[model samples]
Target: MDLPRSFTIRESGHRIHNPFTSEKLATLGRALGLAPGTSVLDLACGSGEMLCTWARDHRVTGTGVDISTEFLTAAHARATELGVTDRVAFRHGDATGHVADEPVGVAACLGATWIGDGAAGTVELLRRSLAPGGIMLIGEPYWRREPRDQATVEGCYATTKDDYRPLPELLELFGRLGCGVVEMVLADQDSWDRYVAAQWLNTRRWLDAHPDDEMADEMREDLATGPVRHVRYQREYLGWGVFALMNR
Candidate 1:
């Protein structure tokens, strides 16, 4: 299976699918202080960036699962490029309910937590594959400010404001799940701009290449309005971070 063509096209250039930049991702890896040969299982690991990079930098061994075949291909290539092909493997499959064949030191479900429906359920799903006292890496979005109205919610690409909680509430959620927030690295507006603005260019280039495609019109419309919408709504209202958690 694969992600929608539109999504794959829009994010084709991205090494990390979420708002995270390579530097932020590297910082997270360092913060984790992963030991050599540490075992990691990354769910919904787009392009296997975290797994591949960590394999190279921390000497970790891991498997990554994602539904997107295109991304899996990129992941394999990334592994090769990083000289970690023997250390990391990527599988094309649904990440939801995916349990590792063996317990892992780090179990992560980043960005696509909807695989377990939401953050709490996602944490539970990750725990199923985690070794005792292992870390759970969860990447989620929180509302930086309350959306003003329905228009604001729509602008943030959410159906309702309930889609995300404020930062404090999100931390409380981890506590409620019987985990403590150990470490976190957040995305700033610059990284957000880098992520969202890059999509605009990708969409524009794709539209030029596939002028007759049926999706062109939709992409065109999105490219036309995406920047302003992101600046006004998502950049201001949405805060994204990858949190490191441990059982309390």
Candidate 2:
């Protein structure tokens, strides 16, 4: 609830809610080897960028689910703009236990892997939405290096010692879950900057419009310190990637 609203006000202007931009999306598209027609199921599909774009470009058809009414409304507008509203649709609902009515070739649970308890649980949940031999698109974060200090972790919003794992451990975790890492597209600092920095501009815009709104103070505080904290902590110590996995 808090996250969905934060996202709507923060990055709704972004064409893609994902970490990677057009470049990384291209890599993911290529890796998926999508044909002229491929179905996709996107869970935690904030704003529905992936489903809308894929439906337009690859002739895919599927459903998107998320908890945010605002996000679904925006997603619907995106679909209408892309002129693919007939093929793809968006629903406002919790993603933790929701599955597609029918199996799809691609079952995606992007950065919002916390949908099903956490990343590990989300992966298993996404699998259930895919048809046999279908792929699971998992977008998750990994540590660039094992964080040695709590300050670094806290800046990235982690307060626990087990919040994240290094790259090697992350890769192994997928393996232990019985998925073969078929392909992956990682996010560089440039991409992270795009994701985080863009938030500043959006937040500023929101604050401008809602100067007298109840959340103005919180927004102003976030705008003031977001960049500094991101640069000092998240950008340095954390790394993220969208991994394409298949059941082996």
Candidate 3:
């Protein structure tokens, strides 16, 4: 019913929980042109930043589901902070196969497409909860440039180059799924650094506070080596974006 403790600990300080900066996230929300009372269902919604922020900015109502109790707690607190508790609800549960009780104007599974195995299946799962003319938002990674070798692919955190398509092919995938890519907000290198490098600091702080914790060594190792790996490979070869789609 939850992500591993280590995973949550590593990202405990993250607000958006992805490579997207707050500005990029707001841009995507504005691009959606949401109307008052528009319903959104965000699967794997991690701290529910999008739901809470959208509720405040766009006056949309939404529900978020995530398997991490820790994250769900933060999400609820964020809703309260934004004074949007009345507009959003968060549930601690598995996101895989999750569906909204009512058809929604937007359905999203960002950054955790493994909920449906991969991008194609995740799009199908989101479609099940979407109303006609609703938008589907998918946040996914793509290859910025073709990797030169298996080691390069692994450095980008993929077991194989096929794990992610190049950016052009990724866009082509939406068309194959009967959805048109209407809008997108991409993550720049600065955002990527913020996302990944911030985790190292969080890990270091955690390690300093709990040197005796069983996970300390692992966090220490991550803090020691994560930066170079990221700057060397991920920043160079990987790209991420949130794509907005509508059924054709």
Candidate 4:
């Protein structure tokens, strides 16, 4: 009932978890065009940043579901800190099959689409939570172009590329899934740097604290090489965005 320790301890001192910075998230929120008091559901809502912000900015109500007790605990603390606890709720459980208690004006699965296999499958699963004509928001990665080698692709992965798709095909896949792209906010190099580079700092902090831990060595190696690989391969060749969609 917990996310990996590595994830739980990432810097919340800044109050963000995703690659898209607060400014970028504001752009995303504007792109979604959520009205005040809109009901939103976010699956795999890491630390509940998006939901909390939406509640604060757009005055929306949301429910964020995640399997990580660690994250949920953080999320609740964040909600309290933001003074949006009354406007939003968080549930600690599996997001893949968990349905919302009520239909929502917006349904989202951000950065954790594997909860339903892939982008298209995740959209299908998220649709059940949406009210008629409600939008679906999916945050996922796409290849800027095809990878040139396995190392290039492996850099895309932490250790190996588990699932990857090219940009155009990803858009088409969503269209074929009975969706019309309403709007999207793509992540740029700065955003990518924010997401990947922040992990290095976290790993460094962890390695310092747990010098004798078995996994420390692996994390150290990952922290050491991750940025080099990301800058060289993944940053230039990969793209990610949160796409807003409507029923076709």
Candidate 5:
């Protein structure tokens, strides 16, 4: 029903849980040409950053769902801080198999496609809640460069080379799934650093504060190895982006 405590601890300071920075998020919102009052449904919307910011900037109304109480608390605070509490709603629930009660102008599953098994099924899940001609936003990772060995695959957090396709193949996947890619905002190494490096600090801070805690040793190990793994593998081989799609 919730993310692991270790994960919450590692990302305690994050607003947006993914690799996207605030600027890239705003850019994606604008690229969608969201109209004032547009209705959006965001599945697995961590911390509700995209929803709250879009509510403030584009005047879009959205409902965000996540399984983390801690993140939901942060999301609610963000909404209040942004004066967007009236515009966005955060629900603590499983996003998998979640379909909007009403069709929405935008339906999204960002970086948690596992809710529907994978990209194709995730698109189908989102499509069920999308109004005709509405946009579907999917945040996913692709291979920026091919991994050369099983160790490299593990380093990128993939079980096998097929875990993620390259960018072109990913676009082709949308086509095969009856959607057309309309727009995309990608993450660069700098943004990736911002996301991954912050986790190290959070882990270190947590470990220092809870040296005798049961998970402290695990966090310490992660702190010891995470940066090198990220730099050598994920930073070089993985590409992440949020893509906007329309039914073809």
Candidate 6:
């Protein structure tokens, strides 16, 4: 019913959880031209940043579902902080099969497509909750450059070369699924650094404060190796973006 403690611990300080920076997220929101009272459904919405922020900026109302109670707590707090408590809601639940009770203007599964098994399945899941002509937002990673070897692929955290497609293939995927790629905001190397490097500091700070905790050793190892692996393999070979789609 909840995410692993280690997962939340590693991202304890993250608001948007993915490689997207605040500016990139805001840009996507603006690009959509969200209107007041536009309803959104966000699955696997880590910390509910997208929902809460859009609720404030665009006056969109939304529900965010996640399996992490810790993240849900933070999401609720963020809604209150942004003075948008009436506009957004966060529920602690599995996002895999969840759908909006009512069709929404936007249906999203950002950065956690695995909830529906993969991009295609995730799109299917989102479509179940999308109103006619509604936008679907999918956040995913792509190969920036083809990896040279299996070792490099593993270093980038992919078990195989097929784990992620290149950008063009990803756009083609949307077309195959009967969706048109309408807009996208990509992550730069600096955004990747901001996302991955910040995790190291969160892990390190947790280790300093809880050296005797059961997961301390694991956190220490991640802190020691994560940055090197990220900069050398992932940051250079991987790119991430949140794409906006409309049914074709």
Which of the numbered candidates is closest to the native, going by highest lDDT?
Answer: 5
What candidate 4 gets wrong by more than 4 Å, as runs, is: 9-14, 158-162
By summed lDDT, which 10 consecutive residues of candidate 1 come out lowest? 1-10
- Which 10 consecutive residues of model 2 have the lowest summed lDDT? 1-10
TM-score of 2: 0.95
**Window of ten residues with lowest summed lDDT in model 6:** 219-228
> What lDDT tens digits, residue by residue, belong to model 1 across residues 29-56?
9999999999999999989999999999
In TM-score terms, candidate 6 sits at 0.99
Stronger candidate by TM-score (2 vs 6): 6
Q: Give the TM-score of candidate 1.
A: 0.99
For residues 10-73, write the lDDT of model 2, one tens digit per residue: 8867766766887788668877888766788999888888888888878888899888777778
Lowest lDDT sum, 10 consecutive residues, model 5, at: 201-210
Candidate 1 achieves a global lDDT of 0.94
Candidate 5 matches the true fold with a TM-score of 0.99
lDDT of 3 at 89: 98
Per-prediction TM-score: 0.99, 0.95, 0.99, 0.93, 0.99, 0.99
- Candidate 3 regions exceeding 4 Å error are none
Instruction: Flag the better candidate by lDDT, 1 or 2.
Output: 1
lDDT of 5 by residue, 35-68 (tens): 9999999999999999999999999999999999
Task: Count clashing residue pairs in model 2.
Answer: 0
* Cα lDDT, model 3, residue 166: 93
Over 1-248, each residue of candidate 4 has an lDDT whose tens digit, in order, gives 66776566454333556668888888989877779999999998878889898898899999999888767777898889889999999988889877787899999998898899888789988888889999999999888877778878877773445476777778888889989999988889998888878878877887788899878877877777787888898798888888999998
- Residue range with the least summed lDDT across 10 consecutive positions in model 4: 6-15
Is 5 or 6 the stronger prediction by lDDT? Answer: 5
